[model samples]
Target: MSHGYPKEGFNLVGSWDDWKSFVPLSRSGQSGSFVARVPIRRPPGLEEFQILQGQDWAARYYPTARGEGVEGPGNAHGRNFRVTPLPSDCMQLEILWDVLGRKVTWKFLNAAEQEIQAGEKKVAAKKGAKARSAPRNQASNRGPFFLVGSWDNWKGFAEFLPFGDSFRTKVKVGLDMKRVEFQVVVARDWNRRFHPTSSGDGLAGPDVGHGLNWRAEVGGKKWLEVTWSPDRAPYVEWTFPDPADAHEAAAEDFAAMLRDLAKEGSGAWFRGMAGIFEALPKCQRSSPYGAKAENEATARCLLATFLRDLETMADPRGPAPGGQRGALKELEEQCEQLLKDTVGEIDYATAGGDFMQEALPVDPATGPVQLKLWHRLVYLPLVMYVRNTVHLYEMLERLKAQSSGAGRGRLRALLDAKGTARESPYSWLVFSIVGALQILYHARAAAEKRGGCDAFPLELLASSPPQTVWIQDGVEWSPSHGSGAGAFQRKQVVNCEPMKPLGTLRKGDGLMYRGIWLPADADEDTIRYQYSFQSFSRSIEGVMRVLRFYSGVASTKAGEAARAGHILMYIGVKFQGWRLAMASWQ
Candidate 1:
C-alpha cells in the first residue's frame, strides 16, 4: 500500500509487512500521535502504490479529533521524498511531519543513499527541540486522506478526485463511509484536471476502516453544515465556513447596485417590479412538493412588474422625473432590501445549531438518481440561482444608473415601443427552452471532449424553503372570483409555508407567505385555499381565525384600495376560509 493507495480492500504486491513495519517502534498502532505511523509500503512498478508515490508522496492517518463534528479521524499529507527499494527489498521512506498529523508524505524515486534510516521518535520525547523544528507549511493541501462528496455538474460526480489538485474528501469518524473530501493539495490547480466521476456513474471505491472528518475553521467556529456519512461512500458535500457568508457576499453585490439605481433615478427598477406583479397570475404554477411557487414567482413577477411600471412612468405617462418615479424608486429599493434580508436569513439557517441531518427533498419523477443527487439537481443549483439573480439585478441596476441622466425623453422611443408591443412575462419557460437548446448544442462537443455540458440553464428552480402544499388545500383567489387564477400554474403540489415577514404587518402587503400548490387534473375551475391573517383590526399578531377562501383570493367589491388593504378580510368571512382549508390540508 503506497502513497497512492487505491482505497482499502484491494491488495498490493508488497512485503507481508502490515502497518507496523513503517510505524515507529514506540508509536506503532497508537491513535492520535505525531510519531505513530501506519505502514503500507509502496512497491516499485506496482500500479496501486505508483499512484500514491507519484514523484513524492507521504500520508498520515489519525482518529477524528474531538469536536470534529460528526465525522471521525481524517488524514492529510503531501509528497516529500521518493523512496526506492534496495537489494534486500528494504524500502527507503521520506516523511515530512505537519500539524495535528496534517501533512504531505514523500516517496521519491531515490533509493536509500545508505542503510534505511529509522524515523526518530518525536511524540515520545514530548517538546523535543528537533521535533519542534518542523516548519508548518500551512499552504499544503495534504491531510490525513479523507473523502467528501459534491454534486458537480461538470464532473458528473460529487466526490470526483484528481491527482494534481485534490478536494478528495477525507472520511469522517464514528460513522459509516461516504465519499468526497476537500483537503489542501500541494498544487492549487490540481482540482480542474482530476478524474471526476458521479455517484450515478457507478464509481464505487473503498470503505475506510476508520472514519475521516475535519472542519474548515472560520472565526473560531465550525460551519453550520455538520456534514457526515453513514455508509462506505465517505463523502459529504459541505461549504466550509458558512453557506450564508457566500450568499451575503452575493447580496451585498446586489444591494450595492440598488444604491446605484437610487442615485440614477432610473424608473426601470420600479417598473420591473410592476411587471412582475402583472405577469405573476398569468404564469402561476405549482410543483409536486406542495410549494405553490407563488412566493418566489411573486418576487420575480413583482420585480418585473415594477420595472415595467417605472419605465412607463418615465416615458409614456406621468412626469419625466417627479414624485411618480420617486415612489417607484422607493419600491425598487425595498425589493433590494428584501433580497438582502433573505440572504441574511439564509446565513442564519446555515449557522443555526441543528445537529441532526436532513433528508433533502427530491422530485423522484425528474431527479438525479445517485448519492446526494438532490444537491446537484437542487441545492447547489439554487445557490447558483440566487447568486446569478444577484449578479443580474446588479447589472440591471448599473445599466439603469448609466442611463439615468439621459432624461426620459431619450428613452421615450424605447418605452413607447414596449407599451404597444406584445409583452411576454419573463418566466422559466424561456430560460428552460434556451437552456435545453444550449445543452443540445454542447452535447456533441461534450461527447468528444469528455467534458460535461456547462452551459445548461437548469437553474430556473429556486432553492427556497422546501415547502409542501397540495390541491386538497385549494389555491388562493384573486380579486376577481375565479379558480385557476393562482400565482403560478397548477396541476401539481407546491412547497412553501407561511413566511412570516419579520416586521410589522401591513394591509395588501402580502398574505401569510405561502406558495401555490395545484393538484393533478386541475384546470380552469378548481379552487385551492390558503390561510391568512384576518386583520379584523390593525393590531399585528391579532388572534386571526383560520379561513379557506376560494381560488383567486380577489373580490371585485374589494377592488382598488382593497388591493392595498383587506387582501384577506374580503376573501370570505375572515377566519372562516382558513378553517375549511386547514381541515382539507389536515
Candidate 2:
C-alpha cells in the first residue's frame, strides 16, 4: 500500500512535484546538427517515450534484430534503441533507466478503503465478536435507526443521527443482509497495451510491462477488463457479466411490492392501535355504559376499515382494493389534494413573532451561562469529540483546565513534550495513507504506476458541531434579540448546563475562573452574557488538534486506553490527584 501526501521520508519526490532529470550531453568529434544522442541501455518503448522540445524517436535498424543486429554468432542479445536529441532552445531529455540509477520505483496500491471496512462488518456480524459497543451521546430518540456494523454494533447509513445517539440501534430484519457480499479489485493505470515479444532478461516479456495489477475472483470466476485511471478514478469495471437488463424489470417490480408491503405493515399497526383505543379497559370499567359503548363502536369501525385496507393490500404483489388495478394514480392525486388542504389550514408562526419569546426568564445563576452569548461562547465550545486530529486541539486544552491550579497535567499538555508537532497521525490511520505511499515507492516495477501525484482530499469535516446550545430566549424559543415589546422576560440561557467542566473548554485565561462573574445583586432572572471565543471549548479543541496532527502516533489515537492515559496524566498533573499513563503514540 502507498502512503498519503507529498511529504518527505515516505514520499517519492518528498515535498515537491517536478523532478529534475539529469542528463549528460556528449558532442561527436565532427557534427553537422550538433546532435545530443543520449545512449540507451534498453529502449524506453512507447509509454516512457515522449517527444518534448527538439527531440524525435525512430527505429535504429537492426540486421537480424538479434545480438546488436549482428547476423553471426555472439548475437542473442539483439537490437538496442536510442533517443535522438537535437540543438534548439527547448530542453532536451535523454535517459538510460534501470532499477538502480536515478530511477525510483513507485507502486500504487488499491485505494478502496471499503475492503477493510467490509471485512470488519463481517467480523461484527459473527455470532460472538469481541467488539464492544460504546454509548452514544445523542439527545433525541425517534429514528429510522438500524445497526448493521459500526461502533456499538452500529452500521447502515447514519448521517442524520449524531454520534451521541444511543449505545446501539435496533436490528432491522430482512434480506438476510449479513450474507450478501461482493468484492472487487481494479488494477488501474497499468499498461493495457504491451506486446509479449518485447521484454527479456527475466523481466516481463514485452507484454509483462503491464506487470501484476491485482486480481479479485467474483462468484468464483475471474472478473476481467475492469478499468481504472489517473483521469477517471479507479472503479470496478465489471460489465454486469449476467446480461443487459437482466431481471431489472423484475427487480423494479419486486421493489414496488416491497414498498407496498411496508405501507400495509404501517396500516396494520395503526388499525391495531384503533382497536386498543376502542377497547380501553380502564374506560369501560370507569366510564358510563353509554359512553363506553359509543367509544367501542367508533374504535371498532376504525379498526375494521384498517383491517379491510390491510387485507386488500396483503401479498403486496396483488391488485388494488377496489379491484381497479393501477388505481395508484388516482390515489396519489387524492393524497396530494389532502396534503395541500392540510397545509393551507396550518398556521405556522412567522419569525420575530410574539410566541417566539421565552416563557420564563433564565434564573441568573450565581454563575455563568445566563445569556445566549454565554451559551455560544462558553457552553457550545465544550462538547467536542476528542479525536486524534487537528480538529479538536483547543477544546482538549480547555477540558484539561477549569479549576484552581489548572493546566498542570492534561494528557495533551504532558504529550506536548512527547507528542509530535503540526501534522495528522497519517501514519496512525494506516488504511487512510497506505496506498498512496506504495505508489510513490514502486512506480518503476509496474509500468502503470509512474508520474502521478499522491495528495488526496480529507474525508471528514474540518471540525465538529457545537457542544453547548446558544439561545436568547430560554423558556421559549424566539428569533428576536432581547428587550422586545410584549416579549416575555427571558434569559439567554434557561440553564447553565455543564457537560464536563474541568475536562476541557476554558479560556487560556485563569480569569474565567472568576466563576460565572454574576453581579452581586444578580437574581434568578439575571441573564448571563459572555463575550469571547477565548471562553469557548473550540479554542481548546484547536490546540488539541495541532498536537494530534504532530504526534502521528497510531496506537494512542483516540482509543479508550489512550483517553484514560490522557485524563490520568492531565488531572494528576494539574489537580495533583492521580497519575497513570495508559497509551503512547506508537
Candidate 1 C-alpha lDDT tens digits along 343-399:
222221332321112112222233422222222122222232332222222222122
Each model's lDDT: 0.25, 0.22
Candidate 2 error regions (>4 Å): 1-475, 478-488, 492-586
Q: TM-scores for all candidates?
A: 0.19, 0.14
**lDDT score for residue 273 of model 2:** 26
- Per-residue alpha-carbon lDDT of model 2 for 1-586, expressed as tens digits? 1121111111010001011121212222432111121111111111122111111113111124432321211222223332222111111122212211212111111111011111121111101111122112211112112112221132222111111111111112222232222111111112211111122211111122333222223442211112111111111122212212323432343344334333433233223223223333322222112111222222222222222222233324433322222232232233334434422221213222221112222223312112222121112122212222222332232222211111212222221211212112111112112222333223222322342221111101112212222222344423222223332332222212222222132212221111122222222222222211222122335445433432332211122123232221111122123232222121
Clashes of each: 138, 67
TM-score of 2: 0.14
Candidate 1 colliding pairs, count: 138
Q: State in Å the error of residue 401, model 2.
A: 32
lDDT of 1 at 497: 24
